[model samples]
Target: MASSAAPAPPAPAPPTPSASSTTLSSDGIPTLLTIPALGIKAPIVVTGTDPDGVPETPPFDRPDEVGWYGRTASPGSQGASVIWGHLDTPKQTAVFLYLRDLRPGAQIQVARDDDTEATFTVERVATYPDDSFPSDLVYNDPGYPALRLITCGGGFDRATHAYLSTVIVFARLTAIGSSANGSGTGPS
Candidate 1:
């Protein structure tokens, strides 16, 4: 049965970070994520990977909670940090239901357990096919503090019972806030 059939094409390579990235070490656990432009304010919960090696999300019962991948660098750390949230459940909408509406230059604030806050500026928001998820792009170390916010997007396939794409928002750390120091500022 060796017919003249070409093998499937390889997946696309993940994008690399530019040379401007700088070093910024992690400090504390993130407790909340707030996006003023999206009117999003949710509690951040530490989550592990699922059997599929994807970051686990909060249960349907707690649609308002967002999940941070505990295995990766915490937000505002020296690498890309990942946070995931649900778009919607069969019954209700979740924390990131409108994530696709985010635009560049938007501010994303993450409050930490130590009463500190890390603020990030949106660089880009993109939607990608789930079949070829960009693991390297989302998890890569960018030589600076970066953040990735993921949520289900695109059309829902009834037969597959899943979303066809994922919405990822990429941002870099621009500031940090603390009660002791008043506020920690980073490069513009």
Candidate 2:
């Protein structure tokens, strides 16, 4: 008689985008973040939060998309623009998987709904475990227009069967330009 193998682990819960803590800019148009190197692009949406003041996970249907907190500072504003996406999914390719391979000075572009594009360059890359996640350092940097691209990485855990760390690509705005309705945000 053949023996049965152990069942696979349950999938990790989807990340919740913060609701109450998020801050939006004066303009209602959400910022669009694009990683040309990885061909990943998505609109940052506004979310509300819980009574305990914790951010909620983003919706599951659009795991490949990245969400920016409207409450946070914009790309060109005073604080770092936080952007989050998923790593590989159980069935399909997820955006930002190659974010770990991005080198310092790599280009990151953000296009506002108002037709303005801000170009940023990678400055550093870091990894953080889920349990000890650094909320303030990653999202509260008030330096030059900064950008952080986040996703899961590290070897898959056998016990947890999920990614061990969150890969964060830290970049700063280097240039800004404008575009017409359809031209798109390209380098000047």
Output the number of the lDDT-best candidate.
1
Model 1 spans > 4 angstroms off: 1-27, 179-184
Candidate 1 lDDT by residue in tens digits, 23-69: 33355788889999999999999987555454466777888998887
Candidate 1: C-alpha lDDT:
0.75
Candidate 1, residue 109: the lDDT equals 89
> How close is every model to the real structure, measured as TM-score?
0.82, 0.71
- Per-residue lDDT over 33-101 for candidate 2, one digit per residue giving the tens place of the 0 to 100 score: 777776767766654343544444345466666666545556654466666666656555566667888
Residue-level lDDT for 29 in candidate 2: 44
Candidate 1 to native Cα RMSD, angstroms: 7.9
Instruction: Give me the overall lDDT of model 2.
Output: 0.60
